[model samples]
Target chain A: SQKIEQNSEALNIQEGKTATLTCNYTNYSPAYLQWYRQDPGRGPVFLLLIRENEKEKRKERLKVTFDTTLKQSLFHITASQPADSATYLCAAMNNAGNMLTFGGGTRLMVKP
Target chain B: NAGVTQTPKFRILKIGQSMTLQCAQDMNHNYMYWYRQDPGMGLKLIYYSVGAGITDKGEVPNGYNVSRSTTEDFPLRLELAAPSQTSVYFCASSYSTGAKTQYFGPGTRLLVL
Candidate 1:
């Protein structure tokens, strides 16, 4: 069976610090990995996407890294703020772009 | 644009009941999908539509049905709802080509009593 795992621990950090989240997968080789941010009582919003061949991709305060060999992806939020507190999800999908397999999100709490 | 919207933000249904979760997107995205999220679990795909008329089953499709009659609407129907059907249902839409970023609706919370 295919599986994706996250830290499962709530991360707490002060504002202006960098937060890193990990996602690991088993049994499936995906061509692209994506990250999403979900706030309370709301749907998830797209954050960033990193292709299998790409080592890193960045958008403003967010960055994503995909390591195909390790079957892992890392999500990072730099200079985070209280408004950045939310659950971050990692999803993987193959080249066909059909369905995505998601990992249980990691909750982040940024204290001011 | 209103983006993606789902109706009946919350509902309670008895066993063997039937209901339809409505989803409409104003973004005119070609790809639409239905997903269910259980407590502490990741989002599980129930069904997806590539276009206005094409639909396919995803990882979990049992006890659920969906139809895509137009580009803006994709409704999921639940027949004979069971206890296992209790979950949060979300509707999403995305552009078909190149780096598909999905926009999700607020979601419908269903509790089967």
Candidate 2:
């Protein structure tokens, strides 16, 4: 069976530091990977997407790297702030390009 | 633009009861999807529609039915709700598949007793 896994443990960091989150998957080959930020009682918002052919993608203070060989993806938030505290989800689009497999997600808390 | 919207922000239902969860998108997207998130778990796709009158089962579609009579609306129907059906349901849309960014709605929280 295909599976996606995240740390599941909450990550705490001081404001202005960098936060890194990991997503690992098995038994699946994806065309692309995406990151999303979800707040309490709200829907997830699109963050960044990196294609299989691309090594990394960045948007402002956020960056994402995809390693198809390792079947893993890393999401980074630089200059993190208190407002960056939320659950970050990692999703991979299946090779068919019709569905997405999502990891449980890691919660990040930035303390000022 | 009201990217996507779901009705009945929250609801509680008795076992065996039935209800419909409504979702609408004004962005004129070609793809719409329904997903359910359980506590501490990632979202699970229930069903998806490629266009009006075109619906297909996704990762988890049992106990749920959906209809897309119009491009702007997709509603999920729950028949004989079960305890396992308690979850936070989300509706999302994207202009197209394969790397397109999906816009999600606030979500609808449902509790089955």
Candidate 3:
């Protein structure tokens, strides 16, 4: 079975600082990895995605790095704000394009 | 685009009862999926459909059933609901592209006693 693990249960950071979340997977090599932001009582919204061949992808203040060899993906948010406080999820799809498997997710709390 | 929509934002059911969670999308996507998220746990895939009339079981599909009769609607049915079945259910859909970025509904919270 495939297993995905996030760095921690929660991370607290001050405003204007950088927040980094880790995702590690085992048992499979995924073609693409994605990140999502989820707030309370709402569905997750897509954030950034990085392919296996791509080293890094950036979107505004959000960035994602994929290391296929290490089976790890790092999600970073620069100049974090209180509004960025939400649960961050990591997901991956295999080469066969099968169902996407999700990690437990790391809750990010940005302090003002 | 209305994106994805789910019916009955919250529901409470007794043991042995049955109900259907309705899900629809106006995006006319080809891929639809059903997932359940328990507290402090990741979302577990229940069922998925590639297109109309093509469905497959996912990681957790023991007590759930789904049908994709149209490109816009995918309904998940729960039979003989149990305490273990109580969780927040989410429906998502995506286009047939390589990215496969799924759009999720607000979600339907189910409680079984």
Candidate 4:
């Protein structure tokens, strides 16, 4: 079975600083990977998606890096704000391209 | 667009009881999915539909049932609910598979006592 792992501990960072989150997977070579932000009691919202051939993708203040060789993806938030505090989830497309397998999200707290 | 909507924001059911979680999307997506999220765990796919009348089991579908009778609706049915079925359910839909962004619903929280 494919396994996705993210940092289980909460990441605390000061506002205006950069917050980086890690996601690692094994047993599958996904064609694409995605990142989502989830607030409490709400569903996850899409953030960014990076394909296997793309090493990095940027949108506003968010950036995602995919390393197929390492089977890892890094999510970064630049100039973080208090409102950016939320759980970050990482997911990868299944080999069949029909579904996604998500990692146990990493909670990020941007303190002002 | 309404995006995705789920009914019964929260519900508590007794063991062995049955209930259905409703999900609807106005985006006219071809793919819809049902997932359960437990505390400190990642979302587990229960069932998914490629289109109307085409459904398939996901990673976890032992105690759940789903039907996609229309393009806009995909309901999850829990028969003989157990404590293990207690979790937050989320419905999501995408335009198509392979790199399409998924829009999620507010979610339905279920508790089995």
lDDT over C-alpha atoms for residue B52 of model 4: 99
What lDDT score is found at residue A93 in candidate 2? Answer: 75
Worst 10 residues of 3 chain B by lDDT: B94-103
Q: Put down candidate 1 lDDT per residue, B1-113, tens digits, no spaces.
A: 99999999999999999999999999989999999988767789999999988999998999999999999999999999999999999999999976677899999999999
In candidate 3 chain A, what residue range of length 10 has the lowest lDDT sum? A92-101
Q: Write down the C-alpha DockQ for each prediction.
A: 0.77, 0.89, 0.87, 0.90
Tens digits of per-residue lDDT for model 2 on B1-113? 87899999999999999999999999999899999999988999999998999999999999999999999999999999999999999999987756867899999999999
| Rank by DockQ (best first) | 4, 2, 3, 1
- Please tell me how candidate 4 rates in CAPRI terms: high
**Candidate 4 lDDT, B36-107, residue by residue in tens:** 999978899999999999999999999899999999999999999999999999999998846867899999
TM-score of chain A of each: 0.94, 0.96, 0.96, 0.98
How many times do residue backbones clash in model 2?
0
The fraction of correct interface contacts reproduced by each prediction comes to 0.72, 0.88, 0.78, 0.88
* CA RMSD (A), model 4: 0.9
Tell me which residue pairs clash in candidate 3. Answer: none
Cα TM-score per model: 0.94, 0.96, 0.98, 0.98
lDDT string, candidate 1, A1-112, tens digits: 7778898889999999999999999988877788998887789898888877899999999988888888899898999999999999998764467777778899999999
lDDT of 4 by residue, A8-107 (tens): 9999999999999999999999888999999999999998999999999999999999998888999999999999999999998888888988999999
Considering every candidate listed, which one attains the maximal DockQ?
A: 4
lDDT of 2 by residue, A1-112 (tens): 7788999999999999999999998988877788999999999999998888999999999999998889899999999999999999998876667777789989999999
